[model samples]
Target: MSKSLLQQLREMTVVVADTGDIEAIEKAKPQDATTNPSLITTAAQMPQYQSIVDGVLLDAHKQLGDSATDKDVANLAFKHLAIEFGKKILAVIPGRVSTEVDARLSYDTEGTIKMAHDIIGLYEGAGISRKRILIKIASTWEGIRAAEQLEKEGIHCNLTLLFGLHQAIACAEAGVTLISPFVGRILDWYKKDTGKDYKGADDPGVQSVTKIYNYFKKFGYKTVVMGASFRNTGEITELAGCDLLTISPQLLGELDSTQGDLPRKLDPEKAKSLEIEKLTIDKATFDKMHEADRMAHDKLKEGIEGFSKALESLEQLLAKRLAELESRESKLVSAD
Candidate 1:
């Protein structure tokens, strides 16, 4: 008998679970996993994850000694939580985990590079090799520049919030490890603006990723393209042979439960057969293209704002926890 549709598709593309929830990740059984500030913040709020965060803080305190400042402790605590979640995810999936840099440093190239190294340093301290972690960065030009340098140093990067070909092409030229072009976010912009629904191969968001995928394959660019931020199964099904696709657990469940022969929609051979022209753009051309594409520009800003807000929330939570700990410590000293 032939393999199931899911099994067949798995042969071509790497499926990554896009969640910080360990239980959901384990259930999906994706080859790789990705976590953003928002997802991590959501996971940290769950009662089940409270002990995990507490344990991380306990370990951070022990490692840094009681003299460690709250900021120091908070950074270490957040890293520990991220790594703990990553460790759990790595057990279920054989591929890398994408842990993001703080969104606040998206435009600060030097700071972004330093933070990326710090994140990797924390992971390496836990016995996880640099190979198993993909430092995620926003797809801004400065972020791309930071990634280019990092890639040369053998640190793999996953460029997130990518929308325009300018970003994709620049990333490809820089030889970054991978680029995640957001699909649903692009769709959301179009849907809200025009009230027109796209179907099957007609999705503008899917088309953006598809164009990038074909461009890379056509030019023999080694950088991988991972379609992300999917809105529906149709977008997922449309880009079946993408290098990778990070999906939410809810969508993964939807794919698993549906009964149909899922077709292979994106074949490199087919891409080559189509005689698509090659594209190489300098800064001027890139800027022009970006200016012409309203959806890409709007979505890119929205994604950055969304991530920035999530990071702020995480910071606020960490601050509150630190203050509580300080209050407890004050009381203990007073009692003594």
Candidate 2:
């Protein structure tokens, strides 16, 4: 019997589950679990998580009482809901959980920092240590600045939606705990741009991550790189020795079922030997390079907007659920 690809990959890399599905995470049993607004919204819709969703909304409503409007309850519920899911995920995974701050605050440095403090505080109030939580933020300049401050305060961060080397360098310089450079989305852009089939190392997404990984290792940056948003097992396989890879459960299943000789693709020692230039990568350099890289620029903006919409949808769901709960309580009182 051959060792599954997932088993082989795990030997060289730390596997993290990028999902909100508890059962999936349980089976995959990745070192860490990550949740974004999109994943959380999808999870909230499931019948099994009804109690979890209701519990969060109802508790927020109860705390606020009649003074809080539906929007207020929904807003409060939205904030606590992410933490509640994080707590549940923390229960099952021993490593950590990446719960994102509100995407609307992505470009707001002050707001981002405050939310990071609030998020970490919530986790701590629940008795979950700050060490076990990674407050995920977008990889915007403002977001990176916020992360830098948070890191000094012992709040770890995962700079997400990262695309170009500019973002990676900025994150490394910021002393961020981790970065989630999107792989699949980059592939999507290149495929549409060139209409050419790319596989293995030729994949633009894989290439981007390889570049960033090598840059980080070569320059001796403390920040760890985690390749994220993979489109297939091939992309995942191509970056085998990454510090971490947050894979979707569907892809994790593919890796688990397939048998193969998975080789280490990225190595720190190998990276150190490779000659790569280090950029100053301040705000001006970051903006210039970001503007030059069409793929990164487009993807970063699209990602933020998409997550923002997911958040909006979640608040709407919470509002509706809150109304349902309120109506039920009203009916019970009338009957009494």
Candidate 3:
């Protein structure tokens, strides 16, 4: 029997699951798993995870006491809930798990660093090693700086929501453990901008990741490039030799079912022969480059807003659930 595309890809690239669904992760058996606010929100809605949500809310209420405001409860609950989900996910995947900080802290370097520490501490308190977790932060300059500091302290970081070469280069300089350069989102932007249907290697998203992969390999940057947010299996196959690829369960299944001739599209040796220039980007240059690349600048802002909105939605969900729990407790007390 011929090997499926997914199997073929795995032989060359490390497959990571970009989901919070435990069942899905188990079924796919990915080496690692990544969770963002949106994925966490989706997971919280499932009946199986209701206990995890309720447990964190109860803990938050007890810790904050009766004087706590809804905001306090929600914020603390979110932190606990994210860690709880991460712990559960760690049990299934043999490798590390990527748990993100709040997107609103994307531009706050100090806040991001502190949150990274708090999250890692939580993991450590739970008997999970810090080495098994990747503190996922946005690819903003501030976030990259935070990752640089954290990376020095033996905490690995995953720079996410990355779009362009500038972001990739900055992350490489920061020595991030990994970078999730979004492939699907870039394609979406180009498609809407140009109104052209792109496919396979012609896809703007595929081309973007390929460029980053080649650049990284060319310069001998140790930072891992994990192409993320894939729109189709074609994009995945196009960058088969990436350091890692965090794929959605849907795309993983698609690749698993399809038998095909998967070829290596990226080669480090080829990158070395391309005669690429080494460029340095300070704060001023970084800002200028961002201003020049309208697509990356606009998309980075959109991605941050989307994640922030999802986090806000998660807060609201926790508030509602906490109220329901309080109401049930009040009813029991009245009966007593």
Candidate 1's C-alpha runs over 4 A off are 1-5, 59-72, 324-336
Report the lDDT of model 2 for residue 124.
89
List clash counts for every candidate, in order: 0, 0, 0
Candidate 1 global lDDT: 0.86
lDDT of 2: 0.94
lDDT of every model, 2 decimals: 0.86, 0.94, 0.93
Estimate TM-scores for all models.
0.91, 0.99, 0.98
- TM-score, prediction 3: 0.98
Badly placed stretches (over 4 Å) of model 3 are none
Q: For model 1, state the Cα shift of residue 60 in Å.
A: 4.5
Off-target runs (Cα >4 Å) in candidate 2 are none
| lDDT tens digits, residue span 1-336, model 1 | 555555656878999999999899888888899999899989988888877776777677779987888677777777567778777777788889999988888889999999899888888887889999999999888898899999999999999999998899999998999999999998888889999999879998999899999888887899999999988888998998899999999988887777667777787877766677767767777778878989888888888899999877776776567667669889999999
Per-residue lDDT of 63 in model 3: 97
Q: Is candidate 1 or candidate 2 better by lDDT?
A: 2
lDDT of 3 by residue, 1-336 (tens): 999999999999999999989999999999999999999999998999999999999999999999998678988999888899999999999999999989999999999999999999999999999999999999999999999999999999999999989999999988888999999999999999999999998999999998998888888999989999988898999999888999999999999999979999888889888878897877887888888999899999999999999999999999999889889999999999
Worst 10 residues of 1 by lDDT: 1-10
